[model samples]
Target: MSETLLQLRNVGKRFGDHVVLKDINLDIAKGEVVCVIGPSGSGKSTLLRCINFIAPPEEGEVIFEGRTWKRFHSAFNFIANRKYEAKLPTLRAEIGMVFQHFNVFPHMTAIENVVLGLTKVRGNTRNVAREIAERSLRQVGLGDKLDQYPEKLSGGQKQRVAIARALALNPKVMLFDEVTSALDPELVTGILDEMRRLASDGMTMVVVTHEMNFAFQVATRIVFMDAGRIVTIGTPEEIRNTTEPRARAFLSSILG
Candidate 1:
C-alpha cells in the first residue's frame, strides 16, 4: 500500500433525476496507474470530472494530498461557495487533465500553447515558461514540432501538444479522459506508447479508456464500472478471470 494521493468517498452525482455516479469510493496511491474501463454511459468520464471538480460530485468529498473539499451544497451558500472557489486554483494546479479532443488552442503554436498554463497558472516568466514548455514537448516526442500551429500538425501531434500542456504543470496525478478515442487508428499507437512510458516512469495516472490492451499492459489496477457504480476492481489477470456477470460479459464482448 503506497501512500494515498487522492481519495473519493461516497461520491455521487446526478443531472435532473438521472444518476451518473452513486456511492463511488476510490483511493489512488502515489505512482499508481489505474485504468477505468466500461461500456458507454457507465459514467467513466464523469468520474474523472468529479475528481477534478469540473462537474463536481453533488454528494462526496474529494480529498487530494490530504486536503478535503467542502461538501457540495446545490445552491452553493456564500461562505461555503467562497471556500470552494478559494481552493480551485491551487487544487486544479495539482491535477493535470487531458481530454478526449485535442483541446489545444488553434491560434497558438505548440510551444506557446504549452507555455500558456505555466505563465498564467503558475506565474512563470516567459523565458522560464518557454524552457519548461520546450522540455515537456520534447518529453512527449514533439520536440521538432514545437513551433508548429495546430492546423499544421497531425491529429497525433495535436494530442501530444495537449499532453505537453498538461505535463508542463507538473501535476501530482494526470487524468486522461479517453485520450486516444479521437485519434485515427494509426495515430493511437503513438499516444499509447507515450502513456506506457509515463506509467513506466511512475507518474500517477487515472485513465478512462476503451483500449483494453493498453489497460492490460499498463494499469496497476483495472476498475470496471457499470450502471454508475464500480462493478469490481482487479488486476488485468483477475479481470480476465472475473466471475462477476457484468464484468464477465463486458470482457467477453471485448475479447471475443
Candidate 2:
C-alpha cells in the first residue's frame, strides 16, 4: 500500500432516471493495483469514466493528487464549466485510459499514432516526441512495429500500440476499461502480461476486468459492485471469502 493518489467521495451518477453509481467512495493508492469486478451493468465502466471526468459524476467529489473537483453538471455556472473543460486535457493525460477497443488510427504508423498526442497536447518538438514514442513502443515490446500501421498488425499488437501511446504521455495512473475483452483468446495473454509487468513496476492501476484469476493474483484490493453500489472492498482473500450475498453471488457466477 502507498499514499492515496485518487479519491472518490460520495460519488453518484445517473443516465436519465436510472442511477448508475450510488454514493461510490474509493481510494486508490500509488503503486497499487485495484481490480474492480462484478457483473455487467454494475457501473464498473462508469466508475472509470467518472474518475477521469469523461462522463463526470452527477454528485460528489473527485480528489486526485490533492486537487478536488466536484460533479460536472450541465446547468452549472458557465465560468466554472469553462474552467473544468480547460483542465481536461491535463487531467486526462495524468490519468491515462485504454478502452475495450484499440482505437488506433488506421492511416498512421504506430509511432506516428503515439506521437500525435505528444506533439499536440504536450507540445513536444517532433524529434523529441518521436524519441519518446520510440522508447514507449519499445517498453511495450513493440519497438520493431514502430513503422507498422494498425491494419498491418494483429489485435494484440494494435492494443500494444495503444498502450505505447498512453505510456508516451508518462501518466501518473492508468485506467483500464476491459482492455482485453475484444482480443482473441490467444492474444489476451500478451496484453495481460504487459499489465502484469506494469503492476510489478509499481504503476498504480484501476482495472475493470472479468479475469478472476488475474484479479485474485495481482490486485492489492478488489472492489465488488452490484446494482450501482460497491458491495464489498477488500484484499483478494477477503473478497474471495466474503459473506456478502451480492458479492458472493457475483464471485460464484464468474469464478465457479
Candidate 3:
C-alpha cells in the first residue's frame, strides 16, 4: 500500500465571518489521485489554496511528509507566525500547483519559466536547472516549444508549459485548481489528456475540477463537496452508483 503523503485534520478556514471550510479531514496517499467535485461556491479551490499556503487556514493541522504544522497569524497580524514561517518555503517546494488561469510569465520562454524556480528557489545551478527544465518540457510534450514565450503559445500549450513548470519542481504532490477552466472548449482536452497521463504514471494529485469525464477516468477516489463541506467520498464506480440522495442528485445534474 502507498504511504500517506498528506493528512488534514479538523481543517477550518473563514473569510471574515463567512466560513469557507468547516472541520474538513482528509488523507492523501502517496501516488494517489483524488479529484474534488462540487457546485460553485463550495470552497473546492479555497481548500486547495489552503493546502499550498496561498491562503492559510484559520484553524487545523496540515501534515505533510510526517510534519504537522499550522498556519497562524502573528501578533502583529501582518505576517504568518514565526515558527510556521520557517517551514513555508520547504512545504511550498514539495507541493506544486497549477492554477485556473495559466500563471506562466509572459516575458519568459517556456523553458525559462520552468527553470526559474529550480535555479532560484532550489538553488540549482543554471546549467543543471536548464537541463531539468528541458526534460520537464519534453515530458509534457512541449519539447519543441522551449523557446516560445507564453504569449506566442496556444492556450493548451500555455497550460502544458504551466504543468512543466510545476513538474520541474519535482513535487511530492501536485494541486490542480480547475486548470483547464480558462481554456477554450477545444483546448481543454489536451490539458486533461496530459493530466490523465500524469495520473497513470503514479503522480500524486489533488484536483478541483468540473470536468466529470476527466474525474471519472483518472481519479482513484472522488470527493464530493457542497456548501463548504464534504458530502461524500468514494471510488469512481461507487460515486457513479451512489445511493445517497445528495450524491445522486448531484450526479444527475452533472451527468445529464
lDDT of 1 by residue, 1-256 (tens): 8999999999998999999999899999999999999999999999999988888888888999999974455484889878767778798889999999988999999999999899999999999999999999999989899899999999899999998899899999999999999999999999999999988889999999999999998999999999999999998889989999999999899989
Model 1 regions more than 4 Å off: 71-83
lDDT of 3: 0.92
TM-score of each: 0.96, 0.96, 0.95
Runs in model 3 lying further than 4 Å from the true structure: 77-83
* Model 2 TM: 0.96
Minimal lDDT window, size 10, model 2: 68-77
Q: Candidate 2: give the clashing pairs.
A: none
lDDT of 3 by residue, 1-256 (tens): 5799999888888999999999889999999999999999999999998898888888998999999878767678554566667668889999999989989999999999999999988999999999999999999889999999899998889999999999999999999999999999999988998998888889999999999999998899999998888889999999999898887988899999
Candidate 2 local lDDT, 1-256, one digit each (tens): 6688999999999999999999999999899899999999999999999999999898998999999987654685998878778887777888888889988989999999999999997899999999999999999999899999899999999999989888889899999999999999999989999999999998999999999999999999999999999988999999989999989987898878
Model 3: which residue pairs collide? none
Best by lDDT: 1
